[model samples]
Target: MAALIMVDEPSVQGGRRVSVFRRGREEHLGTAFSDHDVIVFLQAAGLSDPEEVLDDPRWVEWSGGRDWKRPPMR
Candidate 1:
């Protein structure tokens, strides 16, 4: 799975935007790209500290499970 998360896009007035995908292909969540939604999604996904995700590229992949639980991506 792949996820592209954007926080405060455009400007501070903007919200978060997330795109979910599977096998390098988008899953098509069927909605406009909303902003500021990443906080909720991350919490529900059992993850905190959005900075960690932003700081690392590996967090971009969803290996059918929690990527954080795995070793650091290289």
Candidate 2:
């Protein structure tokens, strides 16, 4: 099973986003891309910061929001 991801549009905002997933294909990666590493690019390229986002009190304060849980194992 793939680890739960914490970011969205991992590659759409970044260029050439890639990852070596432990899980195979056909799993809901929690976003449109394969991994959350794209956030690194977005943060580095001045688009977005994953750390800053995680620091947001709204997201952290909220408890009922969508969580990034591992996909159901086969």
Q: What tens digits encode model 2's per-residue C-alpha lDDT throughout 43-66?
A: 443434455544354422222232
User: What is each predicted model's overall lDDT from 0 to 1?
Assistant: 0.40, 0.34
Model 1, residue 59: displacement in angstroms?
A: 2.4
Query: What lDDT tens digits, residue by residue, belong to model 1 across residues 1-74?
Result: 33454222222222223544445664433222232344456555456775467445555533232222222345
Cα RMSD to the true fold for all candidates: 12.5, 13.3
List TM-score per model, in order.
Answer: 0.32, 0.29
| Cand. 1 Cα-lDDT | 0.40
Candidate that scores best on TM-score: 1
Query: Candidate 2, residue 39: CA error in Å?
Result: 3.0
Give the winner by lDDT. 1
